[model samples]
Target: MVTSSSLVYLIGLPLFGAVFLLLMGRKADKWGHLFATAMSAGSFVLGLLHFFAMTNRSEEERPITQTLFTWIEAGDFKVDAALLLDQLSICFVLLISGVGTLIHIYSISYMSHDENRRRFFAYLNLFVASMLLLVLGNSYLNLYVGWEGVGLASYLLIGFWNQKPAYATASKKAFVMNRVGDMGLTIAIMIAFATMGTVSFDGVKEAVDRVGTPTLTAMGIMLLVAAAGKSAQFPLQAWLGDAMAGPTPVSALIHAATMVTAGVYLIVRSNFVFDAAPTAQLLVVIVGAITLIFGAIIGMAKDDIKKALAASTMSQIGYMIVAAGLGPAGYAFAIMHLLTHGFFKAGMFLGAGSVMHGMNDEVNMRKYGGLRKMMPITFATFGLGYLAIIGVPPFAGFYSKDEIIATAFNSGGAQGIILGSVTLLGAVITAFYMTRVMVLTFSGKPRWDDGVHPHESPALMWLPMALLAIGSVTAGYLFTQGEALVHWLSPLFAKKGEYDELMPHSVVTVLAITAVIIGVTAALMKYQFKSVDSVVPTDVSLATRLARNDLGQDVVNEALFMRPGQALTEGIVAIDERVVDGAVRGIGAMTVGSGATLRRTQSGYVRSYAALILLGALVLLAGIWVVTQ
Candidate 1:
């Protein structure tokens, strides 16, 4: 039986660790690592057990839901603190907890020398637990709690190097941008409650089915806003690009594996709602397409190793969102892509981190080269990641990315075809930038300052990269299993209904192989043969300049949004200090003045008090006598 006890452990373990670290402080550093790591591992094992147990059970027992207690109740409304274990949730469980364990283990070695290792592990553990809650939650309210918790963890981890002002600012930016997206989600939840009578998943889904199209459209749009925020879509994507300020492992966990994927999960979880609203699905496609192109273009100009990876992460997430809009076939493609992405993206980020570790935290590509010889393992693994992400033949990205693109082409009509073309071009760009990264950072003459020696990272760092690299190569092959990826995820997507099977196997294989060859050729021409160093012209065209400057998006946000916000905050504070405080002070002064005039009548003498008392008594007696008359 699926136990409520497992749900409690998922949330409680990390929280207990956080409290334990707070109480123990620096003295508990080693124990904190031990406790946090063990708890994370334990949670992963439980999740695995839950997954296997469900697989052996019948359809009636497929969904194992555990309700701990009632969280909120009033009138006819109620939402329970519940957790769910199904094929869908189990997938998330494996991703978050399994990868989370490796991250923790890597952190043990990676963070060993840092002074605040205890606190670092604490936040890491908490992040994993919260993400687990997010995916496992049976209701939106509980999911939101986990959602905000992951945000909190992201803020903490991004600013983990708080001694640096830039890191701190990056952390704040992530939190603020997410809050902007969250407002939309909160409003959507309220709409669900008002119309549907409850916030629970079953209630909301049933209510949505009953309320018809308009309500579904509204819900879908609001959710899209939320997903846009969480997934780092077009308008709100700046924070994610800057999130490179955090540790490499953090970038892996938050961007690649857990937090950013929350948006895709949210959309997948609410598949039925999107099915009813074509407009909402269209919006998803539009925003995702825009982000895909934009991210790919900007990625080309990023000279920082992590920032380029960050841009690519956003670009890949765009593809996932596009698939999510494609109905059941698309949704399954998106989840499969999420799986492959987690493997490859995490590997890339961690490998980049290992590079940074060996180079004394130097991340700029212009400052380094000729390290492939020294860091053979890192280079090999990272190259594998590059191949997978670029959808090179037989790699993980090939199966999933192709499925989404093909499905989008067919389902989205002519507009879908255009989107598919842009995505195809994006694959080319993905190859170019990745090759640029490898070439600029590893192939050229040593660009380091005099007296510097760069070498391979420690064993602990490379181990995770190695494992992820393997997944990056192998995960997509799971799609080639019985009936492909879509068939595997069929149960979760209720709205798929009766649909034509996807294109024949031979057609899909030919298209996928052709795309891979094209991507590889583009990369080879751009980096290997055309030579990035020699090909870049000194006088760039305006279009090239715009791409070089990240399409000037950062400048616009700073001028229109970020700067104005700072100014507005300053103005509000000034008003609070000058106008509001002054007004309150004036009121206090007036009361004091009135009291002074009244005090003049109170002479410090017993006769004065007696006179006032006698006058009051005489008035009372006169009133009584007049009444009697």
Candidate 2:
């Protein structure tokens, strides 16, 4: 591997922009947004240069690292403040910087009217810089810094309009839940250092096989916990829908395009550990499978456009997670889905923002209807994205998501059958909910409120959506052409030796396609052919109510964890105040009582001393006589 000093610029440029904007405060308001966009664009350009350089190098030398200093050192342990750029890291670099730049441009128009647009841009720059650090860090310890950085930035952006009490609460919910995941990562890193005696990627790779499966499994589970929080998988996914309380640009950049995929990246990066630990691998698959359906079911019942998309994001990330967990056969496909997902999902989010722009920031899809004629650019861009997400032919998701399903089936056992069925089920539900979004938002009769007028967004906003829409249509085909991405990433993974397929690839594709059609048809029959209620129906089934409330995830949490946690905390406080403190107070009272009894002996010392001396002399004479006898 080649060593270079230039990788720092990829993160530094954006970080500098953020610091500069924040330091200047109101003085930079006129220029901050533009400057932040330029910084992100510059990082993207730098990533391109490094990517080209990697392409020119021989396969074995494509990976490069830069060590700035020793970050930590103790007896028999060391970690460096360093950067890594290889086939895998390079993908994230481009995606974070490139898509991030587009979101910045979109925000330039989106948040122009807000009073704190300058600070908003600064947070955007900070977020991009932090995510770059996450992907570029050479060691897990170094990556933790970036991980926390991204979390902080997300909290800032999500609560940017913290004036609203609900928005503030939403941001806090996301922050606290993510910290739960971060603890898992912290433990995993400690395990690596304790067992393997190293925390760097190269070191971990070498030591994975040397360690036993139980240790690896433990490490893998911890890593999965981290991934679950960041990626919004089952049980840890409740914070995601509420996270849509953020601005649309933040949704596109942080939730859809970049930050949400951190888990998938983490899993793929730790392929060696998962490959060695079969039980851990199975657990990863289980989490993914459960979340895929969990998110899809919730998406089906959402009336808020952004929340619906957020649920879809959760489900898609599940697909990537399942692929990543399937060992070597899936590593590349998982990343492929992630990259393509970034393009389409970010574009669709931008499209949603444009619709909201025209409709006075209303988020309810139930209030929208026949907007296709009013917002042509949004309709076209969002339509492409919808097709891609539903696994339509010649679209991005088809190539990437299809391969994931095929790989799940190829695992070869009852496990394969269950997994493959679960993936196809997820696909069906995905199509239904996404199609439901389309029908309610852009199709059917006009249901908008009075005084509402819909129009296309300004060029500054739609232009980014346009660009991302193009990527949505083309990225998958490009990735799969001649197996391009798989080969590029193949060198990093242990060989995926030949294995028997439970079914033919063609058969799997057919099944996935058929499932999608059924879903689309089901949604259309209910929502398109039948009239949709302009107001959400209260007289619905128990299942619909459950889905509407995110499967009562919050209720479950309150019952299972939050309430119990609060009671436990109260009990601990009681013990400290009564049992622990009362004992100490009792000891203090006893000491005070003893001291009081002795105090009288010291009063009026002269007379008291004479009497005491006389008594002592008499006692001494008596003792001497007794001794003589």
Candidate 3:
């Protein structure tokens, strides 16, 4: 039987941990991280139990909701603070709590040396709690609360080392850019409420057919904007790379596994709206296509290991967004990829942290070479993640990513062909850049800086990496080999037979493999035996220069948004000072001057006061006599 209170514990445990840690302050420093890790593991355990309970029920009876209390009530409008546990949300819950548990464990060792480790664990608990809320909410308003909660948690974690100006700036940038998306979400919610008189998912789904197409289109586009901002899609993606300024476990948790996946979850959860608005769905495809390529190009030029991985994350998320836009045919696959990505990407990020721990916290790939011997466990685990991400057969990414590409081809028409080709090319580029990272960081002659020593990390760190690597290798096959995930997620999406393929699955698979081979071959040919310089050179080609500058995204943002915004702000300030404040000041000055004149007339002499009173009375009497005449 499905328990009503299970969902509450899923979200509540981590929050309890956070509050407990926060209340304990530094007093709990000795065991705070361990407590946080235990809380995360507990949430995951509850999630697993709940998942089994839901699976025992028939598909129609799978979705279970629990209403805690009324959150808002005004006239005809009302919303409940409720949680939904169904096929879709269940997937996300496991991913968040499961991967989050591992990240928390990794952070214990990764952040062992820091003075404020307790605070860091607290932030991790908060992040997990927020993400759980985001996916489990039964209503859009509830989702938004969780959404902003995740954003706030990310800012706190990203800027945890607030001593550095760059880290603080990155946190602020992430917050501001996400706000731009949050506004879109807010507008979408308002439109949903205004047009349909409901903000709950079930209510909207029931009412969507009756809503006008234009309104649906607007909702879809606005939702896409929100997704792009949170997921780091094109135009709003510049902040993600800089987010690497945080500790590596932060990168693993927030950027790789949890927070960045919020966008994909949002789109998938709102599939009913996008299914009705083809134009909006088309825009999602376009954004994904552009960003996948955009992220790949930037990834190719990045010298920092974390920045390269961050770029790869953008590209990979772009693929998932593309799948989500393909309508029902792609939602399940999008989620599958998202789950697998959480595994492999988090493993790789943690692997990067392990490398950094060994190498005096160096991030530049140029400073690393042939440390595979020095850190065998890290190398082995990172390689598995790398293979999975590159879509090699039998690895997790192969099943999920190849399915996306094949589904793209199945979209049919010139649009399908074009999108398919672009995605295929992205696969090639992904291989090249990811291979470059592995080869540079683990292969070739040692190019370490003088006197720098490298060694292995503690079991606390590598042990989690090993577990994630196992997932990276096996998750793909288990999910897709027999369309197991597709069937499992069927209740959330349309039937599989409804989608038609433009090409045979085998042909598409062959094409995808070929692309991977080409990319891997190109990377090996260029860097296999080559030694990299410890310092980056100032001189470069134009394309290289562009890549190094993130294709001038900052410049474009400044020119298109920042400068114009600054000018508008300056004008508003001027108007406020001269027009608004000036009017108030002028009125105040007049009142003060009139008071001064009246004061002069009221000179302390009793004769003067009496004379003024007589004059006033005489004038009043003369006016009264004239009126009477």
Candidate 4:
């Protein structure tokens, strides 16, 4: 590995922006957004240089490590505060910084009307820096530092408009749920130390063969818990939709492009560990399968444009996680999907933001229709993203997502079939909901209310979306050309995971396209031909209500986890009150009673003291006389 000090600048520029703007406060408000954007763009430029530099090097020389200082040093255990820019991490570095810079550009106008636009840029800078650190970390311990930084930054960004109670609650919800997942990562690191005697990625990889399967499995499961939480998978996923309470730029930048994708990075980064533990790997696939379907169902029922995209983000991430879970065979494909997803998902989110911007900050898709002519750029950009996500030919998602589905199907036995079928269903549901979003928002007649005028967002906002839309159109094809991305990423994994096809590539493509057609036709027939009620209907089918409520994820969380957790917390408090506090209170009461009794004996007079002393003397003399007689 090459050692280079230049690696720090990739993270430092944005980190500096965040710290500078925050410390300068109001004094920097006039130019804070511009400064922050420049910082992010600088990082992107640096990443591009590194990418080009890396391409010229041999496989062995591609990874560059920059060790800053010793992070931890204690008997037989040590960790370095360091960064690694390898082929895998470089992809993330570019994605985080590149997409991040665009989002920064978009937010310049998106947040212009807000009073705290400076602070908003500060948070955005912080988020970009933290995410850079996460992807760049040399060790799990180092990664955790970035992980917590990300959590903190996300909390601040999501709750930027904290005057609103709902937004505040949403941030708190994301924070608390993520903490629950964070614990899993912590435990996994500890397990790595105790069992493998190391927490660094290289160390862990080297030690994987030495450790028992159960140990590796435990570690992998813990890592999955962390991934699920960060990526908004399964039980930990409920917080993502509500996170739309933040600014629309936030949804695009953090939720769609950077932070949410961190989980996929984690799982794929720890590929060696999961590869050594089949049980854990299987569990990973299961979680992905469940969440993909789970999120897609919820997407089908959401009226809020941002929340609908949020659900799609969850499902798309599920596809990545499932690919990650497939071990070596699916690892590169997972990253491919992640990179393409960064473009399309981020674009769609910005598109949602653009729609909201033009429509007086209104978020309900039910009140939107026939916006294509009014906001032609937004429609075209968003339309490209839509095509990419649904696996339409030549778009970004078609190549990447198809690879995952094919990989899953070729995994063999019952597992392959189940995974393959689940992915197909997920794609169908994805198509249906995304089509619904496009139809409801841009295709039908305008559903405007009083005093609302639909118009295009300023170029400052749509420009970023337009760039990302181009990425959405071309990223997939570029990644798969001559199997470029997988070949580039191949050496990092322990094994080359290419497998013989269970089903021909042609057949899989045909099936996927057919599924898309079915989904699109269904959504068009169901939503496009019918008049959408401006308001959500209260009386609906049980399934529709369930989907609208995130497939009862919150209810399940409340009933099985939240209520039980709350009850447990209350019970613990009760126990503390009666047993722990009661004992202390009892001791206090005894002390007070004893003090009260002793207080009477201190009856304040010198006369009382003298009389008691005289009585004692008389008694002493009488006792002496009796003894003498």
Candidate 5:
């Protein structure tokens, strides 16, 4: 059973580690890696034990919940710091802890040279703890705490290189943009509480099921806003590409497993509300489909290795959102995709980090060529991730992405078909860009400037990449054919239904073959063995500029948010300096002038003062006597 006590360990251990790190100070450096790595690994192992133990329990025993204590108690209102253990929560627990441990190990080498290793690990641990709270919380309030915590951690990690102004700006952008989404989430929660009289998942779901369509629509849209900002969708997603200002491992976590996935978590958790609001569901599909294609196109044009990956992440997240809109079964695939995406995407980012490290911190793919010879492990691991992501056969990404696409086709109407089609195009684009990345970064020739030295990453860094690479290769099989994952996940989607009708082996095989042929052919004709002197453009036409600029969504946000924010700031400052402050200063000046005039009447002679005092006393006495009369 997931008692409040069980959750306490999930969150408290990392905090304890953070506290211990503070106590150890400099002495914690060498031991700090060991301690942090052990803590993360230990937490992961514990989570697995809990998951398996729950699986073995009776069906009635599976949904164990532990409420430690009441957090807020008001009239007919109470919120508990509760932890919920269910099939869904167990899945997330595994992903967070498993991926988290590997990233920690990788960081030991990647950030060993940093001045703030202690702070880095501290934030990292804190981030893990917060995400656990977010996923395991039984109430919306509990989730919000973790939601904000992750936001805080993101800001801290994104701006880890605080000396750089760009990094600081990127951090601010991320935090502020998320606040916009948080506001929507908060409002939705307040409405849910007022209407339903509770913020717990069961209460909200029951309430939403009874609420009117308008209310549901409003709530769903606000929830989408929250998800969009957190998951880096649409206009809100612009910040993520710039977020490459952080260290590479941080990028891996934010993009792959934790932060971006929070939005999906929120939507999936509130699937009941979304199910009731067809309009909101449509919006989700529209946003997801739009972002997917847009991100893919932008990714193609992107030359920076990390930025391209960031764009790719945004695009893939779109698929998940679309899946969520397709109904509960589709939502299950969304989560599945989320897990698989975390494996491969994180590997890809870490692999990029390794390349960056090897190439003396050069991230521009244009400068990296023929790196496969220098860093074979990175090339191979990252290549596996690329293949998996492009939905190649027998890879983890294909199963999830394909299910999402097929669901879109089945559940959605013509509009749904349109979203699916665009998504398919995005898949094609994703394949091309990723191939370009692998080829340009690791194949051809070394275009790095003179004096640049390159080599493989340390074992600590490479090991994580290797693990994720293996996962990328094998994780899909677990979903499609593996007994363990499916049986374990059965409870979560069993009630909704299965995609048995959709999973024709012949169809999947054809899709995989098609993806590989298109991906490989485009890469060969456009980049492979092509003279470096005459590089060919991958774009089929220039008409697709809308996708290049993220479908101009950023411009729309600037109009809707950026311009207004700027105008408001300027207007407030003008009023403060010219009107409000002027009025206050003017009052001060008038008071001073009155005081000067009053001083002028104050003569230095004692007789003058005495006469004035006598006159004032006589006037006061006369006024009192007249009143009495």
Candidate 6:
């Protein structure tokens, strides 16, 4: 049932679109967005067909590979430019193409007024193509190609508005931070090649038993570092907030749905390595736990709408990472959360864009209020996404997030207890911050600037928002109620004995619900009926100040990494100029001085040269005679 060309078209079409748009240039500006959207939608349709084809086959036959060509061959090392279609990859393909199509459609209207609309769509297509390659590639080397492709595309998209200095700076920041993580991935690949003698998933998985625990642990940790960077976990999380400087649609597509989730995919994709190393797995959980709290705390204090959403994204990804770190027991739930998150978060981001569109592109939430009446569609759609994210009952986030919490409690031991507690706290804070965003942006008195007029966005923008909102409401139930996603992903993980929950599922659900209610109530009390000041106050509590400054992450980076790095670079530069360059120059100077002195003996007349040669011979002969005597 699997068509050989299916995977090729799925990845190639978007790449073709990107190339086409780039070649067409400004001439296609009038319709390039439409062409890009069609290409993206086509890929999604292909993915759907592939999914159906996969479903028709038995579970054992679900995974199929399509080899385009042999990519590398050196000694015993061999690689194929191939794609693998399995439950795991199919899920990502759907998420990437599905959400990607919507983002593309939204961009059509969102970027209509811009002069560089064609270029933007081209970058978007490139991004989709890169992501497809990333998820579909069968080997680590192949994945690396896609990985760097993604980085390149993101750099272009994030800095698309390069005329703005801040946007350019943000793009550089994201690029640099990701490089820090990419190094980890690079090392991980090298280790895989060195230890396992193979870089393919199947090869590595099979070699796990033969490989030493230390080597596996090192590889696992390095992979986690890579995941943390791409996924914006912990130390690498700082760039994501600043990344909000890009256009809103870019935020929705790259930050909310596809690019930021790359880290989670990498970790889950390499679950085999993590399974062999408990220490590395524990570190994954620790990073996830810390980041969830870190992002939530920051979200609570952010006033910029996009920055707040970016923080929320960080927090949400942290939750997924936590689940991923739990080993096979939690991988399914982690992916489920990621899928559900793609929908809701993308919806929220697009909705924010809609709000910005109406508010004359204002990003500060403090300047927004009571526009729910004016922009009813944006309000309704955004509210659905907000509800889903807060884990309100029957919403998508409820099923995915609650399962993660339940699984954490069931993981057993002190680690479980601590992680469960952290998850619960994160849920509460998630609800609080999300509720705060909703109330400030839509519920209270209008705080609009004097010249600003609020109105609903065109159907092109709201339609995608509406569809994503619908996904946010229903995806969790469909994926979780029947253990559907878990079963679907079973082949990727080993069968383990099911553990009983420490508390009843019902009790845990209630506890989570209670936290949500408290968070909602707190936000409603503070903002629902009140008027907010647009100007941020300088005087604030210590905690508020810390959160406002992003927990001093930049300061920490400056002190611990940036300043030290700068000093080291300066030292190296000095050495290059003063010592290295000086020594080279000194040699040149000695050669020049010697040449000048030797040139004096090169007289125009042959007699002058002959006389000098005779004198030199006589001196040499005399020295030889004296030595003999």
> What are the per-model C-alpha RMSD values against the true structure?
5.5, 2.8, 3.2, 2.7, 4.3, 3.3
Best model per lDDT: 2
Residue 55 C-alpha lDDT in model 2: 97
Tell me how candidate 6 scores on lDDT: 0.92
Among all windows of ten consecutive residues in candidate 5, which has the lowest summed lDDT?
A: 531-540
For each candidate, give its TM-score against the true structure. Answer: 0.88, 0.94, 0.94, 0.94, 0.90, 0.94
Output the number of the TM-score-best candidate.
4
Clashes of 5: 4
Position 64, candidate 4: lDDT? 95
Off by over 4 Å in 6: 1-3, 587-629
lDDT of 1 by residue, 1-629 (tens): 34545656766776677677767898897578888888888888877887777778775567777888888889888888898877778888888888888788778877888989899988988898789889989888999999999999999999999899999999999999999889878988998888887887777777776887888899899999899999999788888987888878899998777799899999989888888898998898888888888888888877788988888999999999988987776888889989899989989898888888878888887777777997999999999998889887689988778777777656645775687677777777777777778887778677775666788888887888898899899998876566455655687776464434444545655665666567566656655564344234558778778877778878998999989999999999999998999899989999999999999998999998999999999999999999998
Per-residue CA lDDT of model 2 for 1-629, tens digit only, reads: 79998999999999999999999999999989999999999999999999999999999999999998988889878888999999999999999999999999999999999989999999999999999999999989888899999999999989999999999999999999999999999999999999999999899999988999999999999999999999999879999899999999999999998999999999999999999998989999999999999999999999999999999999999999999999999999999999999999999999999999999999999999899999999999999999999999889999999999999999988889899999999999999999999999999998999999999999999999999999999999999999999999999999997879768999998999999999999999999998988998999999999999999999998999999999999999999999999899989989999899988788877988999999999999999999998
- Candidate 4 stretches greater than 4 Å from native: 591-629
Model 2, residue 532: C-alpha shift (Å): 1.3
Tens digit per residue, CA lDDT, model 3, 1-629: 24396688888999999989999999999999999999999999999998898788898888888888999999999999999988988988998999899889888898999999999999899999999999999999999999999999999988999899989999998999999999989999999999999999989999999999899999999999999999999868988988888899999989988899899999999999999999999999999999999999999999999999999999999999999999999999999999999999999999999999999999999999999999999999999999999999989999999999998988988989998999999999999999999999999988998888999999999999999999999999999868888888887765554556678999988999999999999999878855567788778889989999999999999899989999999999999999999999999999999999878867799998899899999999999999999
Greater-TM-score candidate between 1 and 4: 4
In order, the Cα lDDT scores of the candidates are 0.82, 0.95, 0.92, 0.93, 0.83, 0.92
Candidate 5's C-alpha runs over 4 A off are 1-4, 482-505, 508-512, 533-556, 591-629
- Candidate 4 structure, TM-score to reference: 0.94
State the weakest 10-residue window (summed lDDT) of model 3.
493-502
Error of 1 at 557 (Å): 2.0
- Error (Å) of candidate 4 at residue 477 is 0.6
Residue 582 in candidate 2, Cα distance off native in Å = 3.6
Q: Write the per-residue lDDT of candidate 4 for residues 271-390, one digit (tens) a residue.
A: 999999999999999999999999999999999999999999999999999999998999999999999999999999999999999999899999999999999999999999999999
